[model samples]
Target: MAISDVDLASLLCSKICHDLLSPVGAINNGLELLEGETDPVMRDRCMDLLADSARASADKLKYFRLAFGAAGGFGEEVDPAEARQLIETLIDDSGKITLGWALQNEALPKKAIKILLNLTLIAKEALVRGGSLDVGAEKGDLGIEVVVRAEGAKIALDDAIRSALDGTIASADLSARTAAAWMTRELAVENGGDLRISSPSATELLLGAIVTA
Candidate 1:
């Protein structure tokens, strides 16, 4: 099945909106509660909730802007530190998944950065029961290589996501949930590379990608 540019764009937009809805909705709810409560103590609590929700929403937007939207200006290379910080904040908000980072690049091509972020996102999602996520990337003469490993008491990766990342899923079967995986795979292919997925055990999942500049 073939996906047009418009379809891809719509799917990505839906994915972003779906992921952001929770925190954004919390912000709205906090506002409503704060407006009705007159008690000082309860008001303070509502304010705290609003603050946290706003922060969460902001963090997710930053991550998605780089991972899915155009960020880091029009420069060919993007600073790896920016990507790292976004990933750190995203995982920190979860308070469930621990992140281990080992990016060996001062800067990477924009496409490589997006792929790295998306692959890491997918790996992080595999930790259904809260676990460890390790992300690594390196640039070599051939291209950039990224590896993301997730290990936990229970790792659950939807088969559809696996198919999307491996370029086996038909476009007609794609959904917002799998949009990131599909975009990551397409970006890798566009950059003269491919993605790989492996499940060494039920408790572990590994995702790898190699994309050339």
Candidate 2:
């Protein structure tokens, strides 16, 4: 089933909001506590919480801006370094997920960058027990190849998310949890490419995408 443009936009927006709610809420709560707190140590704790929440919110926004927004600027290609920084900060927030980036290209088309970021997000989700995520991209005659590998004590990818990434899910079944996967597949397909997911072991997940140049 084809999702209407309006519906797709709405779902994507919902996903973004859902991902940001926790940190934003924490920031608000920190502010509220700071306003009423009288003790110096508690006040400092509130400040720390606020700072951490603010940083998290900012990092998520930056990642989403490039992954799902037009903040790619006026360029047809984006610097891979920028995408790296966004993903690094995002994974760093988990404090359990480590990132290994290896991009052979200095710059990649915006579509490819979006696909890379979204795929990274999906792979990170599969790392249920915290893990190492490796992301790599390269341009070739066939097109641009993007790969993400996640390995941890426990890794799991939902069937719905896999269907969404493979473009087999019905529009009515789409949810915030799978929106990024859906969008990642759409981006690849729109550019004459597709995404792949592989699980060679219960503790490892691999995601790959190839977008035509």
Candidate 3:
């Protein structure tokens, strides 16, 4: 049986929600604990945990909403500063990855921004062993080009993810890789563009998108 693209997209969204529920729920639980605890010291500590978890969960939600959901509301273009801030927050909250940006454009098409964010998430997942990620964009005579590269000690590019990027896997069964790939493809198509993916070695993965100027 085959899955419709809509269903696949829904499944991807579901997976994202599933992954996030834990930490978000923990934040709620911590808040409840803080409410019941009478000790000022213990209450203070619980409050700290609640605050940190809330911020982290919120940051992830913001990034994921833009990356996996709609592309509008920031207008037809996205401010590079906002994008940079969101990326920074995502890395900081995760606490296991580093992100470096070399953005040449001050603003990007909203669809392009979505693609970039999704690709960044995919690169972060690939760098499970702690590594550095480089994300940059350049403008050419043809259009805008965005590039994401991940390098680490042990990079594992999931086959399902590759399949999604290659348009061989249905979106419904999208794991991390597949969701990113699917989002990338959708953004490319929306912008009259295309995506290119390359994994030259076990520790390196590259993803790029080219869209009209």
- Which candidate comes out best when scored by TM-score? 1
The total number of steric clashes, by the backbone 3 Å criterion, in model 2 comes to 0
lDDT of 2 at 206: 87
Candidate 3 wrongly placed segments (more than 4 Å): 1-5, 71-75, 170-177
Per-residue alpha-carbon lDDT of candidate 3 for residues 48-100, written as tens digits (9 for 90 to 100): 88888888788888888888777467547888778888888877765778888
Model 1 Cα lDDT, one tens digit per residue, 1-213: 567888888999999999999999999999999999999999999999999999999999989998998885764798888889988897887789988989865888888889888988888887878889998889778788988999999888888898998889976669999888998998898779989989447899999999985
- Candidate 2's residue-wise lDDT over 1-213, tens digit each? 567778777888999999899999999999999999999999999999999999999999889988888894744899898999898898888799998989864878999999989989888988988989999999878899999999999888888888898778876669877777888888898789888888447888889999998
RMSD of 2: 1.4
Model 1 lDDT-worst window of ten: 70-79
Q: CA lDDT of each candidate?
A: 0.88, 0.88, 0.79
TM-score of each: 0.95, 0.95, 0.87
Which residue pairs in candidate 2 have backbone atoms (N, alpha carbon, C) closer than 3 angstroms, thus clashing? none
Question: What is model 3's C-alpha RMSD?
Answer: 2.6
Question: Candidate 1: where is the Cα deviation over 4 Å?
Answer: none
Instruction: Quote the lDDT for 13 in model 2.
Output: 91
Candidate 2's C-alpha runs over 4 A off are 199-201
